[model samples]
Target: MTPAARLSAAIDLIDIIDAQRIPAAKALKEWGTAHRYAGSGDRAAISGLIWDVLRRQSSAAWLMEDDSARARLLGMLRLERDMDVATIAALCDGGRFAPDTLTDGERAALTSRTLDAAPAHVAGDYPEWLDPYLAKAFGDDRAAEATAMASRAPLDLRVNTLKGKREKILPRLSHLGAVETPWSPLGLRIALGADARNPGVHSEEDFIKGAIEVQDEGSQLAALFSAAKPGEQVIDLCAGAGGKTLALAAMMGGKGRLIATDHDKRQLAPIHERLSRAGVHNCEVRTPRGEADALSDIKASADLVLIDAPCTGTGTWRRNPDAKWRMRPGALEVRLKDQAEVLDRAAPLVKPGGRIAYITCSVLPDENGDQVRAFVARHPEFSVQPPEQTASVLWDKAEDFAKAALQSDEGWLMTPRRTGTDGFFVSVLRKL
Candidate 1:
């Protein structure tokens, strides 16, 4: 399809998302099913346009001086894609299968507008209600931080040391332009273009042979912060789908006992296969039954209890822009309650001198530093470990890692702007 047609499709999908209140993925899939004539490239281009508009939603609306789908696309083309007015007009020309000709108002607005006078939230492309929370986390640089998160994210992969090393796998996947990640020794990053379809890594022989796993660099780093060692016992308290559990397994080097369990059994389903594929053998999977304690046999015996805690997922906005717009105040409140419950539940599982690594893929202080502070308050036996102290496992890189991340009172915060990873807050707390 022509680029103009792809733009029209994006506008149509945006309207459906706004009216039906459906997820962008669902709408895009339905559109694809109905329009089978649209090839893969067409679908990819359309999806890219849709996501670009969503990422810059507030800023686009502010610049165009209109909140309509077309206006947003017009503003996004100018500000995000760096398309000049003439290029945008040619695409929106009243031709067959193309969007209508740009209105005089749209053209003038696009040509003259600037974000200099817009509110922080508008300029940052995030909800206005979240300003205070962002402020608390990032101080005067909240807008700049949020804007960095609003950009597209690259696909990251972690080499499974249980099966292979980075040097061995790098040459195997060289065609994909995978490069070593900045901070993670085990991570490889594949940069993505605006309309690029996600590469089928699962189909690669290396992945089939259990040498690589698609994990965010930030998540890999968060799991590393736990400092799980060989022969130590670790409990992955919220091992949803076992992403970090696999990382923990690699860190343990097959000498430790790792118990992976989640309160929600549905999230545990895919983990069994993933664990097998990653060639992990020292880990046991625990599924909760009605009114039963899954960890009864292991209470207060674990050297490390890792809680990849449930959160608002604000830090993942680079990948899931729709969720940011759909999130509500009530949802955040519910997440806060969940975090407290998980923290309390994890408190009993850590042995004396053992640590609980509290992690969240959220930039909000309420889910991160604030939650850690409150947890330590309620559980007086536990104290927050300095991020630098916990990250000592990184050896010579520890000081550099500490400098790259934002150190709050409770832990280290990694953001897209700071560490070029998804937003994550990691704090290791030791039981006295």
Candidate 2:
């Protein structure tokens, strides 16, 4: 596709996203289906451009002094893509399937003004409502963190211990030019290249046979906090597709039962197939017949209960930039309330001496550290476990940031900017 055509596609996708209130990915997929003439490369390029624009849409619009999708697309080209005014105008000049010709003002803004003077919110491309939260999360480094998150993220994979060890799989994956993730022993971070479009790694014999699973390094670290032991019963209270449940099962050496449950049947339903594909046998799926059936017979029965609670997903803005645009303060409040309810309901499932690992892929303190603090206050019987003790129990497998952050009684906050992985917060509390 021509550069102009790609810009046109991005404008169309963004409009659909803004007008229909649909997700960017879904909108892109639907657009692709309707435009079957677009080849694989065309789809990839268009998707990349769309995501890039979304990541910095607020700032891009501010620079262009227009908020429409086309304006944003042109702004992205001017600011991010670094295209000159003459080049953009030439591309749009009477070309078939090209974007409509730019107005004089639009062309002038693209060629003349400096964007360095824009406000922090516009330059950072984050919502104004999130300023306080981002400040709290990053302290003095919020701008740097936000900038890092605006860039594309690398692909990460976790070596599944159930089928093979990292040592054995490392040799096989060497052909893919994967490097050991600096912080995660079980994670392999692959370098982006021209052939990055190939999904061969996930479909390879090793992945198909459960030697590895595509998971973020931060997620792998969060799963490690479970500290599953042989013959110990574990419950993934909010297991969505059993990513960490399978990790816990591997930690248990497949010796104990791992029951994975979730309120969303559609999400949990795929776990059975994934578990089979990963060669995970000890894990079982349970769908609550109703609200009453969820807590019955399981109160204080699990040696370990993992609450990978739902949240605003502020930490994953890099990968899902559209989420930042769609999120509202009201919706975030509702999610926080839902998270608290889930924590309260799942707390009782941990045995008296057992531990509960509360986790969320959120950067906000209210959804992470603050939530755990509140949970601890409500349940006097539960005490925050020291990071050293938890680390020792989990085979001493912790990154430097994990050791430092988890050293506190509250737990650890893993950020993508700091840790080069997804943002995750994990707190382990033991019942007295």
Candidate 3:
């Protein structure tokens, strides 16, 4: 399909998304099913355009002076794709299967519009309702921070220490232009362009042999903060597809007992194959049953309890842009409730002097600092560990990392603009 035709399809898809209030993925899927003539390349191109429009929604609308699908897509071509007016006009030329010719208004707007006078929400391309929350987290730099979150994310992978060393695996993936991540020693990164298809790492021998797992550097750092050690019992309270579970397994080096369980069993389906593929044996999987406790047998035995709490995922907007727009005020309330409930569940499982690593992908203070403070308030026996101790695992870079991240009395916050990572807040709480 022509690039122009792809753009037209994307515009139509966005209208369906806005009208039906459905997810972008669902709309894209339905479009694909109906248009079977569109090949994989055409579908990918259309989906990429739709995602970019979602990411650049607010800014594009502000630039074009219109919120219509065509205006947003056209403005995104200028802002995100870096297409000049002439370049954009060439693609939009009125023809069979192409968008209509650019209007004098669109051409003039594209040539003259700039974000200098735009509001924070427009400049940052985030929902307006989140401005206050972002202000609390970033102060005057909220726009810059949110702008970073709106950009494309690099692909990050974790080297499984259980199978191979970083240097060993690094050379094998070099053909894909892999580089070591700045923050995570176990992480390798692959930079992706706007329309680039992902390299088929799953087909690689190293991946098939379970030498690496696709995990974000932020997540790797979050798990590292827990400092899980060999022969130590660790409980990953919300394992979700075992991303952190595998990281914990690598940290334990097959000596400690790692039990991974989540309240939802469907989320655990992918974990067994992942654990088996990674050659992990010391870990156990406990699926929850009908209204029964999965961790009933284990009481006050965990040396460390890791809660990768459920969140609004503001930190992951660069990768999941559609979620940011779909999120509402009530969603934040629901996540807060879920987060508190999970924190309460983790308290009893920790033995005396054991630590609970509280982590969230949200940059919102209500979910990060406020949540941690509230948890400590309810459990007077628990106290937040110092930022220095949490950064100790970072070794010589500890002080620099401490300086780079936002350190509050509750914990440290990492953002794309601050630490070059997804939005993550991690704090360690020790039971007295």
Candidate 4:
């Protein structure tokens, strides 16, 4: 399909998403199913257009002086794709299957509009209600930070040391232009363009042979800071689909007894296959049944309890832009309660001198530092680990890592603007 036709499809999909209050992924999939004749490339291109519009929805609307779906597509082309007014006008030249030709008002708006006077929320492309929270987290640079997250994310993959070393497996993925990630020694990153299709890495030999697993560099670092060692008992309190559990298993070198469990059994379903694929043997999956305690047998015995706590995924906006617009204030309140409960759940599981690694893919203070403080207050036995000591695992790059991340007495915050990673907050607290 021509680029112009793709734009038309994207605008239609955006309308469906706004009207039904459904996720862009769902809308895109339904549109694909209904339009079977659209080839894979066409679908991919259309999907990219829709996602770009969502990512820049607020800023684009402000630029075009209109909030309509068509205006979003036009403005997004200018802001995200960097298309000039004349180029965009040609695409919308009233051609068959293309969007209508731009009116004089649109042409003038696109040519003259600038975001200099736009509000922070609009410039950042985040929900207006989240301005205070973002401001608290990033201060005056909140708009810059949010704008970084509004861009495309690179595909980050962690080498499964359980199968092979990163150095050995690095060559295997080089065909996909994979490069070592800045912060994670075990991670390889593949840069993704704003509208490019993800390479078929899942079909690659390394991925199939369990040598690689797709994980954000921030997430890999979050697991790294946990500092799980071999022969040490670790409990992944909220393993979910076991992304971090797999990373911890590799860190443990398969020597420790790793217990993975979640509150929802359904969320644990994919973990077994993933664990098997990664060739992990020391890990065990425990599913909750009724009122029975899944970790009843290991209370007060764990050396490390990692809680990849549930929270607003503000940090992941680059990858899931549609979610930010759909997110509501009440959702943050719900996440705060869930995070508190999960932190409490991890408290008893850690033995003296053992640590609880609190992690969230969120930049919100209410979920990160604030939660850590609240947890420490409730559990006087635990002491917060300095960000320096926790990040010392980076060795030679430790100081550089510190410079890249927002460090505090509570924890480290990694953002795209600072660390070229999705927003992640990790704090390790020790039982004294």
Candidate 5:
């Protein structure tokens, strides 16, 4: 398909998404199923256009002076793809299967419009309602931070030490141009270009042999900060799909008692297969049944209780841009309640002098530092641990890591602008 035709398709998908208020993934899948004649390349190209529009939706609308699907596409072409007015005109030349020629208004806006005068939220392409939160988190640099998060993200993979070492698995993915990640010693990163499909890491020999697992560098570091040691008992209080649970198992070196459980049994389904494939024998999966207590047997006995708490997921905007537009104030309220509940549940599980590693893939202080502060207030027996104290042992150039991450009285905040990672907050609280 011609690039012009792809643009037209993207505009149509965008309209459907706005009208139905559905997610971009659902809209793209529906479009693909209906247009079965479109080849894989054409579908990929169309999908890329749709996502680019979503990521820059706010800024695109601001520049075009219109919020229509077509206007957003034209603005994205200029702002995101770096296409000039002349270049964009050629693509929209009223040719067959192409978008109509841009109106004089659109041409003027494209040539003269700039984000210089726009508000921070609009220029950064984030929801306006989130401005206060972003301001609180980043202050003067909130705009730059949000802009970085609106950009595309790279694929990251963590070598499963339980099965093989990074040196051994690193060479196997060399064909994909994998490079060592900056922060995670066990992670490899593959840069992705605009409209480029991610390489199928699951199809690789290392993945099939259980030597590698797809995980973001920030997530790998969060697990490392838990400091789960060999022969220690650790409880993954919210081990949905076992991403971090697996990481903790590797850190334990197969000598610890690792219990993985979640409130929803369905979320625990995938953990069994993942644990088996990774050859993790010391880990156990616990699925809660109704009001039954899944961890009653080990109360106050765990050396570490890791809560990968649910949040607004604001930090993952680069990968799930549609969610940012769909989020509401009520959703954040619910997450706050859930986070508190999870923290309370984990409190009784950690032994005295043991720790609870509270984590969230969110940049909002309400879900991160604020939540940690509240938790400590409610649980007087627990005290906040400094991020540098734990990060110093796990990462090289400990001082550099501290400087790169935004540290609060409660924990550390890693953002795309600061750590080149998905937004993640890690706060470890030790029992007094």
Candidate 6:
């Protein structure tokens, strides 16, 4: 497909997304089905355009003085991708399946003046409602932090020790130019290529045979925070499909009791299949009979209880850019309430002197550092565990262990900007 046709497809998908309030992935899938003539490359290019536009939508809108899909794409081309105005104009000219010619105002906005200064709100790519929260979380570097999140992320995978070590899988993935992540011994960072979603290495026999799992380096780091030992009982509360559960299983050498439970049965249903695929035994899946009845017998029984709680997913905007735009201020309140409830319910499952790890893939303080602080305050028996001690138990890499141990008044915040991984916040707490 011509560049022009790709632009047209992006416009169509964006329009559908705006009108139907559907996810960008759903909109793109529907658009692709309707345009079956487009090949794989065409779909990839169009999807890239849509995602890039969404990631920098605030800045793109500010640059173009319009928020239309075409305007956003044009702005992204000129500013983000560094496409010259002449090139964009040439593409917009009456070409086959191109977007309609650029409007007079859009052309003027593109060429007339320098967009040297964007307001903090636009540059941050965050909604106005989130400014206070972001400021509190990031302090002085909020813009830089948010800009980093707005940028594209690398493909990271964790080696499944249950099947093989990183050394074993590295040779198999060499064709894709996989490199060991500098900080994470268990992580491999793949060089970005044209096919971002292909999961090329994951489709290989090694991956299918439980040699590796597609997990973000940051998420792998969070799973390591648990430090589950062999023959110890652990509970992955709110374990959605058990990504961390698999990591924990490998950590435990597939021994001991590892119960993966979630309130939603539909989400837990796939864990059985994944467990089979990964050759994971000694893991059990539990669906809540009712919130009250589920795990009633297990209170204060677990050596480790990990609450991978649900949040706004603000930290993962690099991978799922559309979620930021879909998130509303009102919805965040609902999420905070749910998180508190989950924390309250899961806290009792940890044995005295055992640790409970509170985790979220959110950058917002309300869901992360602040949440941990509130939990400690409400439950006097629990106190924040020293991250250094937790890190020592979790990581083999000396540098990662040192970095992860930094003390915070409440807990640690791992930003993509600082950690070169997805944004995550983990707080380890112990019952006195």
In model 4, where do residues sit more than 4 Å from their true spots?
none
Worst 10-residue lDDT window for candidate 4 reads 192-201
List the candidate 6 regions with Cα displacement exceeding 4 Å.
Answer: 100-108, 111-116, 193-197, 393-407
Clashing pairs in 4: none
Per-residue lDDT tens digits for candidate 6, residues 121-164, read 68878777888888888777787788778877888888888888
Winning candidate number (TM-score): 4
The superposed Cα distance between candidate 5 and the true structure at residue 44, in angstroms, equals 1.3
Task: Provide the lDDT at 144 for model 1.
Answer: 87
lDDT, candidate 3, at 89 = 97
Model 1 reaches what TM-score against the true structure?
A: 0.98
RMSD of each: 1.2, 3.0, 1.4, 1.0, 1.2, 2.4
* Candidate 2 lDDT trough over 10 residues, lowest sum: 191-200
What's the residue-level lDDT of 118 in candidate 6? 79
lDDT of 1 by residue, 1-432 (tens): 999999988998999999998999899999999999999989989999999999999999999999999889889898788889999999999898899999989989889889988888888899888889998888878888988898889999999999999998999899999999989999999999988988889999999988999999999999998989999999999999999999999999999799999999999999999999999999999999998999988778889999999999999999999889988989999999999999999999889999999999999989998898899889999999977787787788888888889987688899999999999999999999
Count of steric clashes across candidates, in order = 0, 0, 0, 0, 0, 0
Higher-ranked by lDDT: 4 or 6: 4
User: Which ranges in model 5 have alpha carbons more than 4 Å from their true place?
Assistant: none
User: In candidate 3, what are the lDDT values of residues 187-214, reduced to their tens digit?
Assistant: 9999988876677999989899999999
Worst 10 residues of 3 by lDDT: 192-201
**Global lDDT scores for all candidate models:** 0.92, 0.80, 0.93, 0.93, 0.92, 0.81
Residue 260, candidate 3: how far off, in angstroms? Answer: 0.7
Better model by lDDT: candidate 5 vs candidate 6: 5
TM-score of each: 0.98, 0.89, 0.97, 0.98, 0.98, 0.93
**What's the lDDT for candidate 5?**
0.92
Better of 4 and 5 by TM-score: 4
